[model samples]
Target: MDALNSGKFAGFNLSLLKFAWLSQSFGGVLFGFAIPMFAAFVANSIGGKLAFPAGFIGGLMSTQPTQVLNFDPASLHWVTTAPVPSTFIGALIISIVAGYLVKWMNQKIQLPDFLLAFKTTFLLPILSAIFVMLAMYYVITPFGGWINGGIRTLLTAAGEKGALMYAMGITAATAIDLGGPINKAAGFVAYSFITDHVLPVTARSIAIVIPPIGLGLATLLDRRLTGKRLFNAQLYPQGKTAMFLAFMGISEGAIPFALESPITAIPSYMVGAIVGSTFAVWLGAVQWFPESAIWAWPLVSHLGVYIAGILLGAVITALMVIFLRHMMYRWGKLLIESL
Candidate 1:
């Protein structure tokens, strides 16, 4: 779909690919289970012959969305439509389960060396795909839907007057992951809240900028507080980048800091983001739009309060980072837990 949208596929025009079913996000679920499953299996394969091919085939057959041809009254044309389910989490679970199952099958069923090809290609794929389909139908769909419903319920409870708990939950989720899958999930949930008009984008908006600014400040201020920059020389440039990225509302700039010292930086990020987000919400900084760039601040209610919250949050994060870094009397030797 993305390729089609780019208008730059193969040498062939393929302009009609614009209407590809994969381009559509049905029920807020992106492309079906196959993509993620294929990816999962490829990663799990470890260059194995059986696991990778089985994963690809099983994933494709796992949760085939019901595509129906319906007449479009307005256009007076027949169109093919399918309800897409993300099945991302489901694919992950299935890959683990089916990967093991396939491995066991191969190990247990000894056949003539010449028949190995048949076992890997025909037998394993069919068996694994059957298991994948059954699991998706009977287990992942219903259970995942229930969990998704629970998350929606939480988002509802987090609505306008977006409660303090709501602010903390969103911000902590956003900052802790530093732009990983967990953060994206929370962002999507928060976006649904904004789209439904149940809550504004205040909490996540605040969170999106806090990590970069806070972690950046830690790098710059280390010289004054800790006698020298605690981060390596290479990170000074990245620190600057982090600060610059913050203005653009990019949280990934803080990823280096988090990666460098996850134990210290992640907690600092969560604490700062939660404080800033909750503070801004408490001060009545409501933002309906999801944009968190510096240009978007003008549209936010109580812009001054929001800015103040960010500053306070950033300072708190910087201080915590410095203090935590200070606590290590020795790097690898002193920390018992780390050792």
Candidate 2:
């Protein structure tokens, strides 16, 4: 905003882009390593004001526990052994709380000059770590389990019999968070079905490419349709990147678009992807090789229909996002004028 106000375009924040793409480009790197590390940095930066070593304790404490899933051979069932840690989320919340707490303590609490040395090294870090750890384990962790568990329950209930709804649910999950935990949950569910032969990859295949392609199309047509650019100069390149990634079957490329206008854009992606996936499944597009959409053209039966479904969804998303953005701009303008 400041850059735009200064009649300059913003730089493509490569750090933000890296954070968005890290999980997709390198498996398990986003939440597991990148997010936790960032969380630690966030905590440390805020808490360090009082010269307390919050980032160190925060980073170590924020380390996410690995999610371990196993199939019980004897029981013939999948067993998840990893306990869900709110480490990634907790660190964000706790960083603010812990940082301010230390800052407040440092400013308000007056200890003996001799004992003041103990305040930062011994007192603050230890105190903050304990508070953050306890809060993370008791409050954050349990809540996370409940939320993710609900997703599991929904996937479990939406069995193959409810084909349309099932497909909608799958694509909606992917659209909700781009490449975050919700998307991962849906991917895991779909992968299990694909492995067991309970479903074709058509649902997953169509869903994966829609957001990027749709968003790319939106950027291309925004000026022509709306007489204004939906994306600025920095985002223009990202649109190209998104379109390129669509063929490679990576949805993370559209993360910037979704994050930039989550309330409006996410729903657009969701509706579009669900429509596309449902259409593809209804059209009897059977896809076995779920790796790359363009390369797997040979693996997809009813190839023309499958591609058409993706295109239809992309068009819907492109139109919907532009309309929504224009409406939001008008609403904001009206509110300011009335004020």
Candidate 3:
């Protein structure tokens, strides 16, 4: 454990972290469950509005929306009605099975790059549709519904206050692990909140902003006090780009910087982000998921307060990075000399 803590096996650590993030982000119940729910919603909406019969709707349900709703409903008599409970169940089963199968297929099959692109675009969608149809009707809808319902209930309990708490926890966790799985999980949840319209986009936007500005400030300040930069010059570009993306609510932007220098980078960014995010929430910024900091900035009710939250977070994080870097460097120098 201590060896892992010291990053003695960096490659293994990174791989493990990446796998964890991928699972939490898209592989687990959250994403796996979500696909069917979304597909069902879309299917129902098309079915309901057009009043398609079950058999009729089932066929075209595979298709994305188009202007062809103009087609005679009577001609497509099979689709002009609501799907049966079986249809609903069918969708969920297909989604869950497809999700696991896709994961397995990727692991088992390592196609060439050219083939990979083609597979992603063509093969996967067709396969997923077939899988969803088979499993939902044959196997897993009820279980999926229960799971989805349970999660929604838990998130609802969090409400506004819960969201703030969740955001804060995520911010702190990011500092603790930087590029580790825990930090990424927190960010993933935060982003998920934004994407789902649970937390305001402003909240997500604010969440992302804190880490980079904090780390950047840390680097700059470290240079100021000790005349030595904490990060390599190459990292500066990555940091700036990351900061920009963070403002746009891309929390993963900070990953590269943390990868370069976790000690100074993680803590610096997280503190800044938490401070910023908390302030944004307090200021009553409006957000719906999938439209975070950048998108919400223009729409925030308290624009001035939102801006202030961002500025404050950035400043505080920068200062923190600088202080930690100086201390760590000086301590390292002393230890080396003593040895």
| Candidate 2 segments exceeding 4 Å error | 1-161, 333-339
Specify the poorest-scoring 10-residue window by lDDT in model 3.
60-69
lDDT of 1 by residue, 138-250 (tens): 67655644564565577667565436777888888887887787787576567645644666778888998998999899988977997855676666788889989999988
Superior candidate under lDDT, 1 versus 2: 1
Error of 3 at 83 (Å): 12
TM-scores of all predicted structures: 0.60, 0.53, 0.53
In terms of TM-score, the best-performing candidate is 1
Error of 2 at 321 (Å): 0.4
Residue pairs with clashing backbones, model 2 = none
Candidate 3 residue lDDT tens string, 1-339: 344466656677767866656754664445433323444444444433111122222222322111121345667643332222322333433433444555555466677887987766666555555655554433343444355445446757967777677557655765455445564445444544444454544554565567765665554565567776666666666667767776666666667767765766676777787888677776675555344556556657778887888788888877776677668767773121110
> By summed lDDT, which 10 consecutive residues of candidate 2 come out lowest?
330-339
lDDT of 2 by residue, 1-339 (tens): 333355443356644555545644554333245444555556557656452355445444544533456899999999877564444344456666667777777787788999988986788767766776676556655665455455446755775546666787788887777778777656655653554355666777788899999988888898899777756566677988998998987889889887677877888988899998899878778886545578778878999889999999999998998888778877773111110
On a 0 to 100 scale, what is the lDDT of residue 98 in model 1? 67
Clashing residue pairs found in predicted model 1: none
lDDT of 3 at 206: 64
